[model samples]
Target: MTQTVMHLDDTDSLERFDAALDALEGHLKRVFADDSAEADRAVLAALQEQVRVLTEERDRLLTDLEAERARVQRLKEANEEVSGRLEGVMGALKDMAPALQD
Candidate 1:
């Protein structure tokens, strides 16, 4: 049998994943409930392969997200440092203006 491909979003939740799996299982059960041996084998093989690919893709995205979160946290720290320097500069300017007016 030819492979069937699905385009699933990377951010799907565990509940959603479970539901999708359950749905496919129910569909297969209904479709193959009194079918010949050949059809039952085909359905089982297709489900196995599809589940493998989907789980792999989901794992990859979660790994990528963790890496991205770390990068964003570093950036946030850098921005805080810059903001502190700008505040200091503004304070210094404020002090200098009062002295100049004397």
Candidate 2:
């Protein structure tokens, strides 16, 4: 079995490379010119908009959650204050009960 090896000169190699690059560029242009490419771009734009909207919504929700947490803390503190005052009033009422009974 004999195998023949073929090699191109520098000029021929360069021409082949240029031709390959031109063919690739033409193919890419044709692909991008198709309707599907436009549809792909539109889909990408819609997805980006959705992501932006979702991010804004997430940030708003986080802000609302923080406000709710702060409100809960305030309510808890107010509840503790009210409970303390109620306990003092109950103790005073208990101390007066014996006098009222007499």
Candidate 3:
């Protein structure tokens, strides 16, 4: 048994996919140059639908990525604020410690 893994960052795979799509499109054009075959039209329609679905998915992923980035930025800001407050409290405690020792 063999398992295959794909990564989003695999540019070579993406390039190959694109090349394959291009080749398929060229072949279809040559086969259906007369534009009268119902089967060819159906295949082209299916391909276009697939492209639309992929485009929608890409848009959704981009939107999700932007939202995640915004959330991360907000979390970083909150962490910094908490850290500053903690430092201030520590400083106040240190000041009171010296007074108590006296």
Candidate 4:
């Protein structure tokens, strides 16, 4: 039996996630200080755009994760099939050894 391990390095994603949070925070601060209607609308638009970008990034990461999981599953199934075949061959060789000793 062989073991398969997966390591995920998500530094870039984490950085992006952090940046999005910071942008949202900054937008909130601006919204609180700006009293004019136009300024408020502009801030709201910026916030909405940030949300859209973050949502897209989240979706992309989820898709990538699902794909990786499927790949790992396929690899595991292939490994099991190969292991079973090897064991069958070894058993057959063992069975033939006694007859050859005659």
Highest-scoring model, lDDT:
4
What is residue 49's positional error in candidate 4, in angstroms?
Answer: 2.0
Worst 10 residues of 2 by lDDT: 5-14
Cα deviation of 86 in candidate 1 (Å)?
A: 0.7
Cα TM-score per model = 0.63, 0.62, 0.61, 0.58
lDDT by residue for model 2 (3-62), tens: 553453534644565565556556555765686664577755565566556556556655
lDDT of 1 by residue, 3-102 (tens): 5444555356645876786687677666667565466587687886787787786677678767866876999999999999999999999989989999
- lDDT for model 3, please: 0.71
- Give the range of the ten consecutive residues with the poorest summed lDDT in model 1: 3-12
Alpha carbon lDDT of each predicted model:
0.75, 0.68, 0.71, 0.77
User: Roughly what TM-score does model 1 have, to 2 decimal places?
Assistant: 0.63
Model 1 stretches with alpha carbons more than 4 Å out: 1-15, 18-39
Error of 3 at 40 (Å): 2.9
Better of 2 and 4 by lDDT: 4
Q: lDDT tens digits, residues 1-102, model 3? A: 994543455346445656666676676566667566667567777876776676565566667657766876999999999999999999999989989999
